[model samples]
Target: MDGQWVEVADRVLVRRHAELDLSAGLVVGDGGCLVVDTRGDERQGAELAAEVRRITRAPWTVVITHSHFDHSFGTRSFLECPVWAHEDCRADLAENGAAARDTWARWYRERGDDGIADDIAATEIVLPDRLVTGVAELSVGGRRVVLSHFGPGHSGNDLVVHVPDAGVVFAGDLVENGAPPDYEDAHPLGWPPALDGLLGLLGPGDGTVVPGHGDPVDRGFVVAQRAEIAAVAELCREVAAGRMGLEEAVQLSPYPRETTVTALGRPLDGPPPAPGGREIMRARSWGCPG
Candidate 1:
């Protein structure tokens, strides 16, 4: 799918990029359109913009879900539109934008694709003009779209676009469809509540949910993921409580056990405990115990 648009509801379009199969949404209201998340780089973002133009000629407003390179770095290509994001996302991009560029550059070089990496390096990070704290509502084409910050889940700063009228939520990196959830920069303990907030906004298992990395799913999928997350949280708690060693916890976890264990700041079995001892303990105490 070079780029396929699925009509999510009456006027919402969920666009899935064929390159990485990354998903984004376009909401058409009476006045204009609201874009959920941009693509990875300039070329990709331009392609998505073209798709939007093909569907509707209305002016667009962009909301970035997080500050990851794949989602926010492409905003520069959509510079003409007003961009919105969490305040921490802006700070992250400002502080580590160059480092991200360098990391991607090295990655592409290792794959013998210097041009792709160079293009990523050339991509400028665009910060959001409208920064949000907890929740903010905006009128896009006359329809009310709610942007809520569900604490820290996938990352310290993550946003989910909830269209109550449409009953569709554009979840950035909070939920994944295939492989396993990415916990590299994730708040393992806080992730469950973030998902809970997403489920809460949905109100019921009736609307379409467009995830950052897979095909759109229903409320049932979200609920199932919640259970998986809960299990991981329990394993983290076990490690923190010394009831289970890191390796033992990883052995017990149901989802990306190894990755989730390490991301929770736990030791990789026999090694000395992590330095940020109190933080992990707090996370375990606050996380789902069952």
Candidate 2:
């Protein structure tokens, strides 16, 4: 919905879209704002910036959830403002940023949108000026915003922003909505604990949760997702131990079969008649057993 805003609370504004939504928070005390994540590219981010202008003129600070191209690559549009992200995010962008750009550009090109691919190729990578290890606090318009690094779950680096007073948390890709979780770069073993940390910080879903994608949900939603993740982790353990074939594990997955297989951090041993028929194994040992 272009030029539209959904107010999660008095302080939180969410711009919704079919693929993903971007969240921006306003802190009334210091007359400052914190943008959770930028959009996919310059044009998308510029559109988001225009939405921010409609709400408040407060100086803005950006908190990147992770370094994925869709979330962090668009930060170039907001570079004049202060940007904050996990330290590993900066390193990821430095090492693999160009490769990510090329990959996505090819993806868009295949869709026959060469212009979009070119736009993505032309955008510069933006790194965070400020980095946090465990936690960092800032006053935005006199309101306190807590930026905490949960752990190596979704990615080696993932950050979630908590506003205690307003009882809102901007949970990055740590949580997804409707779509299956993407764990190609995720620590499947460590992912459950990251959700645990989010639960602990947000107090059992009593507050509002602004996920990196999808509509805002309550703590119960997270709790349900956590159960699903636990099940996937269990399946991973089984596949690793040879207790279950990859096909069986995929069938038991709470998420889509393809996503479950990829998140196991391995590839199929052989080709299957169908996409999910072959047994799978982890490429590297993760030191866990069923």
Candidate 3:
């Protein structure tokens, strides 16, 4: 199923792509549909839009998981519909969209992937019109879908799509399946709790969890990954407190050395800290464990 939609639930579908091991979602309801994460570029988005049309003639609303180029740049093809994302997503796209495009394009071109690089360079960035500050409920046709911001994990603004009846959560980049969790724009201290909040959304019967990239996963997988991330978070604290060296933290991390190094370098995601440095403020906001 390289470029086809695989149904994980009755009407909830995921289209897996070989480009970046990317998976885009489609939730079909009685009178309408929901599209999750438009592909990478206008051409790719158009292809996805056409595929969505094949499965759903019902009007579709798009929700981006984060502001990463691959997940958001294709948004132009699904224009005129209300697009939803976290508020920080809008700011990220507005401020760094061009830079991301340039950086990725250059990287791709350097690797001899000029075709994809050209597509990235030519794509226009589209910002979400509907922003979710914390949590927002949406009705797709008559089906109930909830969008929630669990706190910063993969990016400053990570939005998750929850289809309650289906027990499937579109967990942007918060939970990666095929590769190590990205830390380039991540908050190491906050990531584990973000996963905790995500895990909380899963009921006893709920199992399917869709990652930003790779195949769908289950609660067991999420639980294990959460533990791994939590280990990294603890290592970050250890390094910060002078209890452990940076290389030692990297050596102990569950993820790769490079990934751990990047995560270790990031500041906790939030406004500038108070005089005392309130690291727990974000944890409290997400209701994370002390």
Candidate 4:
């Protein structure tokens, strides 16, 4: 096993990986099961799949939170089962996955991590067969799981998974725990409202949130992060309107300087580019360094 899974709620478990501090989730139900985000590459995916087997032998369905390599590349190992994600995710993978593999492989190779580099090089991208445009529900065994796409935020196709029975929401990369939000492919203006939709999932109850990376957080943690992100969005707006300088935005940002700089460079208006329209490769310096 890569690591011991923490049961955040009844039948809801989150497995944390040390490579990127990535978190993958499992929700076991009476009849079937739901897997949230496979690991980085095929080998990592295999390890996670083995972990899932240890938990329950029930059939599983996969949901990709976004098309980032850490969240999506390992999906091939869990194949032969339906893979679900935002509609744009399929397009993102189809358009940029190969480029991501090549770029990240080169990045790891330069860092003398040839094993991972080769693993990335060898990964055969698998597009999500089942796509969600807005929201969709799944019946995993007897429990209900909701997959919702609340516009663009972290990426053009960020997917949020809500397990209503357990009061758990896997918020993907929309909400970061240990680090600042990644703005490499983020929609700075749209991120805050997107989190608003994510917060809506918690309703009035105290629910557990398993972020794409780091430990599970409470609703309050997300609330604070949302404010931070909204602040960044405001900073982006100011810079766009000549009300604040880029340097000032960086200085005032809640995130680190480099992250703030990246956020400032992204579009301040409009949504993230649709798949095949424009693609931003994962920068080595940004979140989830490969």
Candidate 5:
């Protein structure tokens, strides 16, 4: 609805913003508090930090769900505390963080959003200081929270934050609600399995799932989205192996054409490899079998 604290469970709150319809989370533990994501830039991060202060005076530890500019860029405002993320997250930021920021900054500027552009330009990239390759147990105010990098999916660095005590899962961009799945940097094949791991961790029954965007959802929602993801994965393999044509695959995909194209273009953990000469010529001169 708005970027206010909407409690999903005990001591767990998801703040949904209207800007990108993105959601960040706050978990208050007796020892300290855990901020699921920082936001897009310094200004937004400061605003979130202020709101968090109103809820609890506890010191905060940040768990970045991914390296995306929106979910991870707003860490400067929380420098007094530790920031955690998947180990690959650090590498992803180090490799492409500046370019990513510049890209968004220019996009906003071209759209006449100078203020947002300037804010993004001014926000220094804050890479996660603590890294987690596997399940890393943490304690915030005596309560336990687990951070796990299920596998390469939304990105090579997607991390899911689980609060077993609160029975809530902060499923970064792994499970989007307000929008279709973002496939710009996704591993379509691996995405489904990663989601499966999250499902396994949640282990059935009723529980809240705080997606990276939109309002928090339930287990059934994740299940349905996972099924769509599974369809995409199957289509990817079929298309890659030439058993399914791009246009036909697009027609059959669970998402829109553009989203399906982007998702199918990427294979596993990185960008699509350069097409061969024949492939390039075929695309430019004549259409391929469809």
Candidate 6:
């Protein structure tokens, strides 16, 4: 809730929101600056923009980490500027943004948080103007910010923003700290490989990894989380391959049973989730799957 900027590197700053403990990045290069993953709504985005102004007045380009409402909805406030995200991110927002907005709005209403619901409803959904599929390089001020989509994991649209100069990876929802991974729209079987790609990007040593929410973490943290995902992926693979039963797999899961059930329930590469995905997505709290 402080909305203060925590400088991780020379010019790379992170503003960790008190709400949801959401963290967004601001990289000040030489030419222009880069803002990673806008907040939840227009008000929040405006607040973020103002916070960035407190740091620098350089023109800013926005890179969305994924299409989740908390990360993409506030994007409209930064409109008229270049907004970047995975291609699937654009598609997801274009197709489901409104529905997600309505669902979250209704959810808040049910919880008697009419103020939050109203803010969500009032915020206009904005899709990415530019898209990143594999990897896209950009000059933020004078620094290089690499945006990458390492297949599908937390979400098909998850993008990892790597700041080599800063030795920090802005790992959106793909890597969550202080909470369990959200699998509402995750690719369970593919999540581990995606994390493997992240580890590869990290290379050697303990570089900083900023999760979507929570405090910044180190490589060891990611490694431990990676193993959890790997176990989940293997379990899902075994289940899908008919070598294991879902119930038995649940018993052996590394995560809590509910979280494990949710992870296993996610679609790997098949038709679609067996319903409840939307509701789970809508009901997600602090960007964490319930």
Q: State model 5's lDDT.
A: 0.83
Q: Give RMSD (Å) of candidate 2 vs. truth.
A: 7.5
> Per-residue lDDT tens digits of candidate 2, residues 1-290?
32367777776677764433444444434578888788667777776777787878888888888888777777877769888888988877787777777776666677677876787888788878899889999887778889888777767788988888888888887787756776667777677888998888877447888777667888988889888888888888888888999889888898776688786654222111222111112111211122
Query: Per-model C-alpha lDDT, please?
Result: 0.76, 0.72, 0.83, 0.86, 0.83, 0.82
Candidate 5 worst ten-residue window by lDDT: 275-284
Ranking by lDDT: 4, 3, 5, 6, 1, 2
Off by over 4 Å in 4: 270-290
Question: CA shift at 267, candidate 3, in angstroms?
Answer: 2.2
Write down the worst ten-residue block by lDDT for model 2.
Answer: 279-288
User: Per-residue lDDT for 7-101 in model 1, tens only?
Assistant: 98989988876544578889998769998888767777787888888889888999999987777777877778889999988887787767776
Highest lDDT scorer? 4
- Candidate 6 lDDT tens digits, 15-107: 998767789999998768999989888888888888888888889899999888788778877768999999988888887788788877777
TM-score comparison, 1 vs 3, better candidate: 3
Q: Which residue segments of model 1 deviate by more than 4 Å? A: 266-290
Could you give the candidate ranking by TM-score, starting with the highest?
4, 6, 5, 3, 1, 2
How well does each candidate superpose onto the true structure, as a TM-score? 0.88, 0.87, 0.91, 0.93, 0.92, 0.93
What is residue 152's positional error in candidate 2, in angstroms? Answer: 1.4
In model 5, residue pairs whose N, Cα or C atoms come closer than 3 Å (at least 3 residues apart or on different chains), thus clashing, are 30-141, 31-141, 32-141
lDDT of 1 at 50: 85
Residue 3 lDDT (model 3): 88
State model 1's lDDT.
0.76
User: Measured by TM-score, how close is model 2 to the native structure?
Assistant: 0.87
Clashes of each: 3, 6, 0, 0, 3, 8
